[model samples]
Target: MANATSGMAVNDDCKLKFLELKAKRTYRFIVFKIDETVKEVIVEKLGEPTQSYEDFTASLPSDECRYAIFDFDFVTEENCQKSKIFFIAWSPDTSRVRSKMLYASSKDRFKRELDGIQVELQATDPTEMGLDVIRSRAA
Candidate 1:
């Protein structure tokens, strides 16, 4: 997992890698969109979400946005470990999908069960998904 305090830039490659991991089922992910059509598509693609936060909100560096947090889980082989994936969907308009963000981490990192299952979860902060942090750097 990357360090949240390091101020890393999110890029297309990272997004692509996330999608690839989702496809491979290496980790689970969720989609947050107010549009019913888009939500339906996401449900069809990713299956029903494990949890949903309809009234979620986050404070960004430049502004505050009302968003929804969709959560999912991925259990490692033999139910050894669990991973939590969160998808943050910012809906400034409340009528469509606008800004999409993603965060994923393991439930536990430094511990393993007697069966030799290790939990390798990552830590993240909402500020890392702030618009100023995610905006195109070229500008």
Candidate 2:
């Protein structure tokens, strides 16, 4: 199934369903943790309509917890009203992704700053990532 919002192609409808699951009123955000090496940081995206942090811990293969950070960097009424955008990192070996830090002047001014940086950096995957914002939440 393809995501209606982000336009990403989901492998199946089940993933789409999971992505569309409604958020709770008291939705939790990111869980930030540092691994033993502490050279890198991990930020797990967590919230309602999916497994809780406690549940994830119970199911994790290693007792060592994976750290993550949540960034509701882009949430708008035009988008899914209850939606949040998160950037989570587990390890350098885990994924290429990094911290949840958004180096904007302020939260309200992130989009503009992001656009400026995008142009400055010449992002290879530059297709306007608000759609990815939805796709990541689905996973």
Off by over 4 Å in 1: 1-27, 36-80, 85-127, 130-139
TM-score of 2: 0.22
Best by TM-score: 2
How many times do residue backbones clash in model 1? 2
lDDT string for model 2 (1-139, tens) is: 2223322221232222223332322333334333324322233334543444344333322323333222233345467433343432222222223321211111222222111111111111213223354344534
lDDT of each: 0.29, 0.30
Q: What tens-digit string does per-residue lDDT give for candidate 1 at 29-105?
A: 32222222322111112223332222122222123222222233444557655433334433232222222222111
TM-scores for candidates 1 onward, in order: 0.20, 0.22
Q: Report the poorest 10 consecutive residues by lDDT, candidate 1.
A: 106-115
Q: How does residue 84 of candidate 1 score in lDDT?
A: 38
What is residue 127's positional error in candidate 2, in angstroms?
32
